[model samples]
Target: MEYKVIAFDVMGSDNGLIPAVDAAIKLLGEQKDLKIIFVGDGAALKKELSSRKHNPDQVEIYNTTEVIEMTDGIMDIRRKKDSSMVRALELVKDEKAHGVTTGGATAPFIAGCHFILKKIDGIERPGFMPVIPTVVKGKITLLLDVGANLECDPEDLVNFAVMATAYSKAVNGVEDPKVALLNIGEEKSKGMELHQKAYKLLEDHEEINFFGNIESRYLASGIVDIVVTDGYTGNIALKAAEGMGKSLLTEIKTALTKNIFRKLAALRLRKAFKEVAAKFDYKNHAGAILLGTKSIAFKSHGSSDKVAFYATLKMTYNAIKNDVVNKLKKALAE
Candidate 1:
């Protein structure tokens, strides 16, 4: 289960661009069947490659004259015809690579995915499926439509649940994954009309193990493995969780360093506390699969460092090896 080749957008990072590329190439080179292709200014990448003493022969560069600036809006997709994001996706559309990974602008990546890789059969919209860390046995949950398709119909949400459930079972090793819709309350009457409709749809579907409805308060409880929602709400919830985690860490650090006595106590509990903190580190799980795409495409955080970038590449490799695209397609066709 080797990925033939993995393509990356090499012009997105503000810093660590060379190190990220070097790490990806080094990691993939270790795999016998894996080859790496970078899409960006060929001369610049080659210069960086030479500095790292990395073999340019093991890597292929798809030269693109235009580079999409990180500050550009999603409309930049149309503005930058020769952008690396566009070129990377073009490789996927042309079957030059098994998948593409990018730590680039989210809007441009979404636009490129829609314009180039396109949607899968029976899927009118593509969604972002990101793995959320759970408290249950250190397992991960799949949250679908996380800032990809902002407005979604009932059928779209239903499809998201199905695709997310399949992805959780396949990648996270969950059997008969419990699916829940994000709602304001557990009661059937809670939430908006669309949520109620989605609830009924899940309840009526026998294929997935619908776990009624889950409130935001119970998000990290790990009661369910998949939480389905439209991109707007899901994106806010994901960002909120991330912010909360960072804030909590800041508060803890401040409290622990207040005085000599507290600092000593912090040192005593530092190892255990760090272990707990690592559970919520989003960088550990950096890639989000652009579900419903014809080919695998991963969207990573734009500000990701070398570690996060490497994690994304690893995720891309696993998704290709696991045949995630075909699995999602077959599940959707059913």
Candidate 2:
């Protein structure tokens, strides 16, 4: 069987390289046809792997002298060209790897991808697309332009829908995915000029199943498969949802242990509470893809733990296995 090689930039993560290294070893154990190039401090990575029992043939380390910090500026990609993040991306650019994953700063990582991987043919601009869980269990929605481009035009939003729809079909197994424009109202005339214009274009586009405008409050209602918006707005919405989920879970925990009666009640409802908590856990959906790029450039959470990092690695592997980049090109061309 043929193997797919993935370049993992295992630096600049908030928790250090342990999470990424542990996840890589676990992934290699299950995926026999996969190889991982851990791009970071060679000695440190080798030391971490020494205690872990993994197939030596499936792992390699590419030592880098530098790392891109979270505080680094956007142009640091050029200044720190020898950094782990840049080296990992280069593996894909040089056709040595099928994809790359990083837990680096958002700006430099996205910028590096744009300059290094370049855009897919016919893609005007790349967007950040993340899979989000909906209110319905086991269902997900794709949100794009989440801090990729600060602003976008109507045509760019349409391109995001096209890219997202292609992703939904290929990876999510959703055929003819229904897409919506995130707006203040459900009417066609809602939102800014960009949203209004995008609504019309999405409606006219034959490739996508346009579901019209959807209010932000309804995002978790599981009414749409994909939601398109500008980066500025999408970023805020994503953060707000993440913060709200955490706040609600905290509040529930506090309420459960307030008194003797509540504590007793909590014991009886522990399983139910866990199920609800799992549905809203951000760790379950921690990775976001820099779509419209020529290769899969996955950005895991900067503060990811082993569980979150593993989820991202699985996502990157699935993207490569499903040939998502080529499918995206076909979607745009058609």
TM-score of each: 0.93, 0.97
lDDT string for model 1 (1-334, tens) is 4347888887776663675676676666566567778888898877776666444555787889887788888888888889888888888889889999988888888888888888888898788988788777676778888889898988888898888877777777788999999888899888998999999999999778999888876777888898999999889888888889889999989999999999998899988997877788888777798998889999878777776777788888788877788888888878
Q: Give me the overall lDDT of model 2.
A: 0.91
lDDT of 2 by residue, 1-334 (tens): 5788899999998999999999988999999999999999999998999989998889889999999999997899999989999999999999999999998899999889988999988777799988888887667999988988989999999999999999999999997899999999988998889989999999999998999998878777888999999999999999898899899889988988999999998999989988877777888789999999999999999999998899899999999999999999998999
Instruction: Write down the worst ten-residue block by lDDT for model 2.
Output: 276-285
RMSD of each: 2.0, 1.1
Best by lDDT: 2
Over 4 Å off, model 2? none
TM-score between model 1 and native: 0.93
